[model samples]
Target: MRVRNVRLIDGVSAQAVQDAVLECGDDGRITYAGPAARAPEPRPGVRTIDGQGGTLLPGLFDCHTHLGVPSDRSLVEAALLTDPVLGVLQTTERMKRTLDAGVTSARDLGGLPAGFRDAVAAGLVPGPRLQTSVGVLSHTGGHADGTLPGGKSLDLDYCEIADDVPGVRKAARRMLRAGADLVKICTSGGISSAHDDPDDQDLLDEEIAAVVDEARRHRGRPVAAHAQGRAGVLAAIRGGVRSVEHGFGIDDEGCDLLGERGAFLVPTLSTVFQPLDPRKTTPWRYQKKLRWNERAKENIAAAIARGVDIAAGTDAGISPHGGNLSELSYLVELGMSPMAAIRAATSASARLLGVEDTLGTLRAGYAADLVLCAGDPLRDIGLLSAPEQIVLVAQQGVVRKLTLPERSGSCQT
Candidate 1:
């Protein structure tokens, strides 16, 4: 299949090439990318598409997501305890929504089991190409543990709670044994956990080191630390965690450490401005807690200045799925150039997740996962949020969603 006359944002910079052509094969690799005039003649019976000179980019990626779980407390608890069938169904629907929004790939930070991952890989569901971390590992009463007050018992099957270095090691091995592709550790308290303070560190330095070491044993797949405060961010960096999840109160020293260590920072900017409803299960306490410590703007600026690789992540279950592109806009507002923001969500994000060799860019021999928009995202990042502006979404060279019809064209081999 050949796509012609499209504005190309090749996942590197904001500069869009006018009158570009992209060719993809059934194996999903991009076969060509260059000026339309120089494109090879299409073979007989080859599918042809005219992009109308719209913006064509490598598909967007969300570095952090929770599949089949709501941010609401009761629903999360119920889902964890319920049968796997419902969870799979919920994941399928959420994945479709994510694809509809032009996100071709996502990393499931938490809340998905190995079965769900297998189902998605087997083509049983319509969704993003997923890299999943089975439930998170946390200390008792820590951020990922899901412990509540009033003696209410939250299911523990999804999360492994550890209190020491040995415990952390054991838990990491358990998750890997259960088919985890990556490990999630709560180094700090978080907004949703009912009993912990978001500003406080939860895991000890040794415990964090143990988790990182275990992740390394699995060929360096990387560890995602749910860190909020300065101390937590520093601890995770020092302990060799690959990425810091929230980094709400990251300071200059923390930023320096992360930069020196080459750790990526995933600032889920959508959380800072998420619409809150006090009547929900989390209530005003969680909302107020988030509002007080939301330092995404300041921390992001610091990280950017310090040369820390910034990746786009939305914490989708908390903010809302399918609006992941809003993170790019927020990154631009926080001082990243529009091109830098786009790269962070695409190439940079895939690199941080250790999938760069196969995904992220739009070069020949790379996956044909791509998106076509109506305007130049380099000059206007806001074009990402306007759903009506997205014209087409393709994953693995297959047209998943198309808002425009194919153009008329014919060419010989």
Candidate 2:
């Protein structure tokens, strides 16, 4: 496949090359990338695609997501209790919406079941390239415990609740045995949890270390900590977790530790502005936690200044599925340049996810995942918010979505 006359942002930098041609082989790997005039002659029966002079860049990635689940426990329970099959079907629809929004890859933080990863990989469904964590590990009454304050116990199948170091290690190993691609640990309380405060550290440093140690046993799999408060963030960093999610109350000391450890921060900014809908049913005690929005932004800016790697993630299940792109705008509002924000969503995120060798950038021997837009994203990030501007989306060199129909005429030699 030959894509011609496109402005190429190779994911290496902010510069865009004009009149570029990207050639892909049958195996869905980029074989050639250079000036259109310098591209090799087409084979006798090869297909050609004209880019309509649009900007082409590596596809965006959402580093945090939850599948087979809803942010609201009531909705999740209702879906499961009413019809299990229908619940999975709804999850599939959400996945499709995520891909249609041009997110080529996503990391499922938790809530996915066994065999779900293989099902997606086997082409049984149309969705992004998925990497799953199975279910999160939390202490009893911790963020992932799903316990209410009225002594009512919610479903705990989606998470492993550990109360000690040995329990934490056992839980981490269990998640890996269940076919998780990574390990997710809830080191802090969260706004969505009815029994805990978001500013509190729920897991001890030793317990977090045990989870990280167990995760290291699985080669290539990293530990992701759902940390919100300063103490939790510090514990995650000290425990050698690869990435920190939320970082709601990350202070200067926390920022310094993250910078020193070279840990990646996935600040899910969309969660801050999540609407006050009845479906949310967030606890009133947790409402005070939302006030950390400004502080979180300041901490993120500090991290960026201190050379901490920043990646883009929307905490998708908390917000709507297709609205993940809103995170880019928030990052920019928090002082990240548009180009940097794009890189964070692409190359930087891939590196953090340990898939940089094959996925992130547009280069020879890399996956042919690309998104073509009508305008340059570097000039205005808002262009991404409009679905009409997404002219084409190609995954593994196959044209999955296109705004304009293919031309009928043969290639112009």
RMSD of candidate 1 to the truth, in angstroms, is 2.3
lDDT score at residue 69, model 1, on the 0-100 scale: 70
- How do the residues 249-307 of candidate 2 rate in per-residue lDDT, one tens digit apiece? 78778877887887889998878766556435654634555567667777777776665
Candidate 1 weakest ten by summed lDDT: 71-80
Worst 10 residues of 2 by lDDT: 404-413
Task: Give candidate 2 misplaced runs (Cα > 4 Å).
Answer: 71-80, 278-280, 283-286
- Which tens-of-lDDT digit does each residue in 1-413 have in candidate 1? 77887888888744667789898987888998767777777756667777776888898899998866755445545555667677667677878888888888888887777776677678877788888888798888887765557666566577788898888899999888888888899888877677776678988999998888888989776889999877788888999998999887788898888889988899888887676666664564666555654465677677777777888899988878777798888888878888898899999999987889878888888899999888788879999877667788888888888888774445622
Q: Which candidate has the top score in lDDT? A: 1
Q: TM-scores, in order shown?
A: 0.93, 0.94
